[model samples]
Target: MSIHLENFKNNLKLRLDDNPQLHGFQTFKKTLERDYFSEVSIRICFKEAAKTENLVIEMDCNLDLLEMLYHLQKGTWGGNLSEEEDLPPNSSFARALDQLQELNEISIDVEEFSLFLNDCSIIVKKIYSNSIKDQLGSILSTIAEHYVYFTKGLSETPFEIYVPVFEDTIPENDYTLSKIREADNQTKDYFGFWGLYFDSEDDAVIYDLSNKSIVSGDLYLLNH
Candidate 1:
């Protein structure tokens, strides 16, 4: 049976209750809030940006995004001996941006991101890679520069897309804005933004995607 994005809520909650160690993965944001399992290796964030609630869920299982990140962090770029590698198969570029944009800002669930909440934990994941960023940026830049020539003033110019990031490594809390400053002084200023993390495969991929997959870009710049 093909799975839709409308069946993974109860399964998520059940995991939280069954796992004793997942309480540590609890997080909150401007409009979304929830708990997660770090071992299962999943993340859920509550976002209120875009005038909607976004329960962003990501699994770092068989194709864990974190694995690429760790590998890239350790100097494993292919082809040029430098430059971070691209995202694994079955990932989404837009979804990647959603996670980055909400790292330290208000949460948001807009556009094509509202079909993630349900009673199940698994879902088919779309693949994507940021290695295409350079290519993507170039294409976007060119489109903007040539918009006037093509549209003849019928359309506005293309603009640069800025992905938000934090200067620090962690944040105060990973739950919600209301609880970030009060969670734990030690956990503060350590890049503890809100997001649910699943440590189990069964708890993450209810639809088919490996529950352990967590896709992330290269946090460390490559040398090649």
Candidate 2:
């Protein structure tokens, strides 16, 4: 369970190099999800704060890794071998995870780990100005965090790294969302917001300022 940091760093460089579009970007946040053994995701954000804008990368897992680790510790991890039994009715989302296949050992210099990045490169083409380009190093240096470690046994906590993103302006009241709720509300707190603008009006991402989470309108209705 120990993470091979040197090896991972080297491989990550190769992975970045292979993807030409992700160059010139430093880490924003990286995490080893509980489902890290099955699926990995990379989120790229092109954020603009005043005249300063930079591409940020945030990595996370789709499922609760802490709960999975708890199950693993109890030796009751592989009860869901039958994929059909694990799936919720009419849902094809979990079809790609083969928990049994992921349990096998991988030899260094011989085999690769079962975990693979499934989030096809999320491309965010943002052009940063010269002033922003000059601020990249200092910005990254101020909040550079890297969480790459391995464990022989289960880690009590999930691995996470966070690099800060700066914004130049205060939240404005130009959009209806700004009037919806403030970040310090007792019921909901959303310190920031990001509007995923598409051609269609149906798509929306709402932030619960207090909770510091985003819930899409479509998924919110489905879950409720």
Candidate 3:
């Protein structure tokens, strides 16, 4: 089945619109058609910033991977296995696994594939400052190395990097932030709360308190 591109775009736009920080931000999207898999690239830029120094966030969605994941979840890709019924060794699902391994140049077992499907985003950030950019680079690099599927990149002028903040690391409360700081040995100043695309049932951005709004022992949730 072909991927529903319009639905995906609309869902992303709705989530972006809900964020107060991104209230006046400009968004642009382009679809890259490919043989095996299509890619949808979404670019977001704050309107008030200078063109040269604008803080931009880019998200690239792999439609084929997402479709496969959807099928897996719906039991259409042989993901639903029962005690009485085992997946055929030479099934379509098995072939898909082999194809994925060849495409990514990585071997993935069934258990690993299940975990990989849960990690959906490849967030690229173009920040404004060098100091913060370097710090983020170090922090995100560590995170990417630890997580099997997470990736990271860093660029010069408008510092660009890939950051996939795990659910546990996202600061919903003071305790969580404190724990994160303790583990990373970084201050709260290093933690910059930005909008995130959570690709679950809600399909919304996880909005946390901005850096300026964070109090000493209190972390606020901007929206549910």
Candidate 4:
């Protein structure tokens, strides 16, 4: 079950066209042959500077998982991780995997995976799993939680990744400001922007900066 590459490209283009901020970006896809898993590489570039500063997303997955994503996106699969359950029981996709496991065609392990952005690329590692249930859970969870970051051009809006802090140890109004000041100093000292961090509760709190007492949301010499 290979990925439907053409469908993926068409759908992605539609998604990008719907967002004005994403108009500057263009997408290109490449397939890679690998012994362990299939690979689909999608490179997103700013239209004005297509040659350099491209953001690449590499998806590495086995045949079954590849098919799963395709089906999920197409709405052929019943499972939707945006629901409350981490892994929905009613998914025929999971049941099919279970059948394959029973036949010994595939063996599942405890799913372990990593998702990180570094050096202008986002990498989604293949989950190593022996349990089909755990593997399904992890895959669905990742898509539900982080798919937006991949679709949205994070490079254009670096502040989208900013986290705010409101700690009891620090004054309510000054917490985020203090953290930014600290980061600004580190950026000067290191000759590169220090990454932003804040209270865990502030993850993706992307509204009303004035209320948060944030005077500025600028990245100088920041690395992706």
Residues 89-115, model 2: lDDT tens digits:
211112222221133232101011121
- Please give the lDDT score for candidate 1: 0.25
Q: Kindly provide the TM-score of model 1 when superposed on the true structure, using C-alpha atoms.
A: 0.20
Query: What TM-score would every model get versus the actual structure?
Result: 0.20, 0.20, 0.26, 0.24
- What shift in Å separates residue 155 of candidate 2 from its native position after superposition? 32
Candidate 3's C-alpha lDDT? 0.29
In terms of TM-score, which candidate is stronger, 2 or 4? 4
Off by over 4 Å in 2: 1-16, 19-35, 38-190, 194-201, 211-224
For candidate 4, lDDT tens digit of each residue in 1-224? 11122332232231112221222122211212121133543333234533222233344544343344455565444333346555553243344334434544223221212122221221122211222233433334343344334323232322212111121132346544344343322212221112222233232222223332223233222112
**Model 1 lDDT per residue over 74-100, tens place:** 333111222354543212333344454
- Report the Cα lDDT for residue 136, model 1: 26
Q: Which of the two candidates, 1 or 2, achieves a greater lDDT against the reference?
A: 1
lDDT of 3 by residue, 65-168 (tens): 34534453444442334546454311333333344335443222221010112234333222223323334323333333322221112211111112222133
Model 1, residue 6: what's the lDDT?
Answer: 28
Q: CA lDDT of each candidate?
A: 0.25, 0.24, 0.29, 0.30
What's the C-alpha lDDT at position 160 in model 1? 13
The weakest ten consecutive residues by lDDT in model 2 span: 107-116
